[model samples]
Target: TTQPPLDDESVYRIFNKLMLEGKVRAAVRFVTERGGGGVLHPSAQAEKRPPGVTLLDVLREKHPPQQQPCEEAFLPCDSLPPLIDVDITESTAERTIRSLSGSAGPTGGD
Candidate 1:
């Protein structure tokens, strides 16, 4: 049996699933290859694999999530800015704070 062409909702669902699984390149590929033409392979990687495995499943599993979310900084610790010790509570504005607009007090009209 042949699979029907994917609709917008189905396309979005597949794309989101790949993205959330942290497979950006695969997600883009899926949209470009499958979405652009709706030509899903009849049986991508069917032989020598599990019964229900799919192309998307293989792409997502190619890279583990634990290894995907790190910045590309040479010295990661040095890239971060130092924390500020200063405190400014909104309820009690610091004395140094001044209204950016007209003076908080009434003008000469006061």
Candidate 2:
């Protein structure tokens, strides 16, 4: 069924999960695919950091990619990303529920 587009919370949630799971590469890729454009991509830089790359880890502690380096890197602000196979929770509002079941949006007049 259809759902609403991704929001800042959605992006941050997924990003946080990936970081906690130690899926640094996956997190970077996820952000990139979402709208990060790659230059400001988050990096464990495992090779560059030489086993002490805790940038994402540190950011994980800060959270939600707001007013931070990691946030600027991969967190999109200008545009919405294309929906991926994200495990969307049942947080969608009533409008989405209605639309998915084929009900149109509100009519202008009864």
Clashes within 3 Å, all models in order? 0, 0
- In model 2, pairs of residues that clash are none
lDDT score at residue 25, model 1, on the 0-100 scale? 65
The deviation in Å at residue 18 for candidate 2 is 0.4
Stretches of candidate 1 off by over 4 Å are: 34-110
Best by TM-score: 1
Compared with the true structure, all predictions reach lDDT values of: 0.67, 0.64
Top of the candidates by lDDT: 1
User: How many pairs of residues in model 2 come into backbone collision?
Assistant: 0
lDDT of 1: 0.67
Worst lDDT 10-window in candidate 2: 101-110
Cα lDDT tens digits, model 1, 31-96, are 888333333574465556798887667767786676454576444464667888976787447343
In angstroms, how far off is 42's CA in candidate 2? Answer: 27
